[model samples]
Target: MTGTPLLKVRDLSVGLETGGGMRPIISDIGFDLAPREILGIIGASGAGKTVLSRALVNWIDPPLKVTSGSVVYKSQNILDLPAQKLRMLRREIAYVGANPAGALDPTLPVGQQIVEKLRAVAPEIAHEEARKRVIDLLGAVRIPSPQMRYHEYPSQFSGGMMQRALIVDALVSNPAFLVADNVTQPLDVTVAAQVLRLMRELTTRFDTAIVFISSSLPLVSDAADQILVLAEGRVVERQATKALVDTPEHPYTRELISQIPKIWTSEAVAIDLPAETRKPIISIRDATRSYRVRKRGTFASYSTVRAVRNVTFDVFPGENFGIVGESGCGKSTLMRLLSRLERPDSGQVLCDGQDITRLSGKGLLKFRRDFQLVLQDPFNSLPPRTAIGAIIEEPLKTHGIARGAELRDRVLSVMREVGLPGTLYDELPLGLSAGQRQRVNVARAMVLEPKVLIMDETLSSLDQTEQFKLLKLFEQLQAQHGLTYVYISHDLAMVRRVCNRVAVMYLGEVVEIADNSRLFFDPGHPYTKALLSAVPTLEERRYKPEECLLEGEPPSPIDLPPGCSFASRCPNAFGRCHKQSPVLTARGNKDLAACFLVENTLSHAAA
Candidate 1:
């Protein structure tokens, strides 16, 4: 705190060229970053966090300009630097964005792309040396088997691995300043915690100052030394992480902190299901789904990817059921089986006591009417060229349910229910906000009058404020229509707030299932404990991260080892765990878990 600042910004303001005139995006922003220090910028969506981050690195594009103030890095004002000098300065200032999949070239090997970037930044470095640095950095970031993964393409890497690879790319040049913009937003809790920890370590190791930008306050508090809260394009609060979290000065900052979900608290209550609807609206019994993929290098040799393995669950009517797991744990695949998008290899998917897998033609159409799926990624889900009204009305037209003026009325009615204005009905989705786009998605799904709605990471893309609003809307819609929700997500806090019952999946298998209160308070499976420990929160952790946090990734689904799928990563795994697979059995009142530790504990208690 006493040394020279690595980067300094004063009275900074960014403006966008609008039809009427120039409009201010971020005004009078000021911050200073010491060497090896992390300054976290926290705000909701449209709060100019991204714009401010881009401006800090002089990456602002046309129509958006830094109207005033200075961004000085190492005594040099970067905002006033010329094109040639600014390009050279940027090499020392790195940036890693939120979207990892779109950051790298798919055609090239993952390591090779970083090597190319290093060479471009410093032509003096040889190709082989650059490649070595990349491989070394990859390992430093905790990516497994860096040497073997060096030749693999981006598509071959999982989401968490690819994100770490991108971090390696940013640090390859040994940048003095790094801007990480929402880097951990898309990752699951375990992977996100890993990334946050890694970034803090990298700053000390590389002697780099980082500007960490995110929409999550608890997440920022976990990684940052100091926190800056933004609201409507202005700095509302700034203080040390503990000081701000404990005694907030600004009302906006207090509001942001209040929105954070409280786990292990009495705030979450178990929902009571109606006894009249005795049967489960949807049930999956031993459902297994697999895919055959050609090996990376082999021409004819292929591997079977057991995406969803013997997954069993029941979703009763009028209750919000949740499916949660890390990426590639087969949550989406299981959702597809429930929605009839894919048939199981050898099991049954029952809808209201009837096997819907064999249904086709009119029967399948009728089944579709009862089940609707809402996908993640609000940007790409809706058609860009189509009008909003037409997009929402497609399901109705496809089913031949309505037409003409009647259809228009129905579409507008659903739009109003989802809080979308009818004036934007004829507008394309190009300029809409992320929340607005998701509302359009909701309206489209609701127009069909489905009895069950399957949301696959639907709220993952939105900021906390938008997510909260949409969740309130969902509660109203469910209450009005008696709809059952199947929410599949990696966000544990959201799951804790909404779901009546939750199913925890691991490596294509259901590892644990319990009521909302039971799952959070007293988990049976070790894997479930690990997930809870990894969740980021301001409250005191119920599970110690150092003890329960897993070290390595799960074994490959294609070549899954015999015995318990979680044996390798589980901290409580034992000899029997490696020799025999555990079956889901009762642990408590309606609680089920597939772990030998639980079985042993229950057996010992009975003895």
Candidate 2:
């Protein structure tokens, strides 16, 4: 490469020792990241995106080892360097990993983890100096109240916060380049957007080149300057982001882009309860799920953690209703409540106009068919030991239409339907790619012919191509079988693509619900606006980020605010927002929001 690009690789090959044989992971891959270029590496899970990143970082763990490759970091051959020397170089070239949880020790306080990293990179710096640098690093990643939060364990922090902490840890070295591998996957729309914006700002300020690798095409398209598409552990296509996105030369690349969730009619709409049907499929009235904390040896010994505080919502037939919020906002808890996985402390869960709140034994088993949950992480969610074929057939065996040979044929058919080849039936979950495993997850959930599929961030781990493919499949299934969905995800972009309506959740309750188109273009709640504005759009516009009407973190869900949950983050929140909890009030046809701004905005927009 001309004048030695910051990180240069030539003819890289990585292989894993399996059955006493070296099986190739990545073959003959080569790329360069110059000082100014942020190269986006786009690929599906099996395409070896993470493997390639590991190869570049020279951090390939165990069984999967790099056999032959020359990874030159700014003219120095990192392969030739000693472990100590490589460690020194790593200080100059950081690696931000995929599993944010594994990067840090869960037991250690965040402050200590970051300080330790700083000390490792900067050995000469004193402990106190390193600690300040740690807090400064926290600020760099936009973590709030670093002083108070420095001692908190990883479990105490949100998924987005944990990721931000890891980013801060990576940036402690002030590296010349950073390898961000699926960094945006764990975050919500607002957090993901802000993190990317901060990363962009940091890259400029620090003049750091980033090798941004992700399964997301839309994110890669929006964030990266250049694009590299990988398939089957090889480079399939490489070009500038705009050129590649507009005119993708590869058929695979073309298929990948078409799958990203976008609003069908070009506007984000809120979840609108259907008017034709008076009675909803599932209804919750005054739902409240509270947990009491009791410690050993105390008179009082406990405090109550109210997860769902008088929450109420309805799900209609064939509706793709969504719940959007920060982590621990009780969205998931509420989901479990609605699905009857757990009983609400006090509320009525009416199913088909019957109060099935205390659904026990046989009744709950029947309800399971009505609602099926597609999980987030396919690796952990899928049975690793079982064959892919058997995994898909389990639901059928328990509660299915066919029997014996008929069931086997149906399983194979379902496998093909979800894009998993029939031949992959014998394959274990470990053998398949991340995307392939997720396909199996989809297949297993769909195999039983459930009426309502509860998708819990099912598309989070997939590349944009795979995501679009699955989403399109959902559309087909919905059209043909009239499958309803309770789609739960943090990716607002994807939410825009599939859902007819959405509900924004913050701290265990629905803050807003409406038609998707109106919600996107004209967000009502400050949180909704912040969330919508945070999504990194491919379409550009002249806008100032500081003009966003939101800031600050929501109070701990364990001890929530007395008034509106978003008051701390809302710029428009006055005394009313702080003093009285705003309920979801009707603002328009099939639209509602728990905010004061919508009243003013709706009136003004009408005027």
lDDT (CA) per prediction: 0.89, 0.77
For each candidate, what TM-score against the reference? 0.96, 0.86
Q: Please, what are the lDDT tens digits per residue for candidate 1 over residues 1-607? A: 4489999999999999989989999999998899999999999999999999999988899899899999999899988899999888767999988778688889999998899899989999999899899988787665656776798899888766787888888888989899999888877898788878877887878888999999988889999999999998999999999999999999999888788888877456356678844899998999999999777678999889899989888899999999998877899789888988889998999998889999999999999988999988888899999999999999999999999999999999999999999998899999999999999999999999999999999998788889989999999999899999999999999999999899999989999999888899899988989999999899899999999988876787878888998999887778898999999989876889998888889999999
Candidate 1 collision pairs: none
Q: Candidate 2 — which residues are off by over 4 angstroms?
A: 1-4, 15-28, 61-69, 128-149, 155-158, 231-261, 264-275, 292-306, 396-413, 416-426, 541-546, 559-562, 601-607
Cα shift from native, residue 178, model 1 (Å): 0.8
Specify the highest-TM-score model's number.
1
Q: How many backbone clashes does candidate 1 have?
A: 0
lDDT of 2 by residue, 518-585 (tens): 67776667777777766655554222346662455567555677778788877777988887888887
Cα displacement (Å) at residue 400, model 1? 0.6
TM-score of 2: 0.86
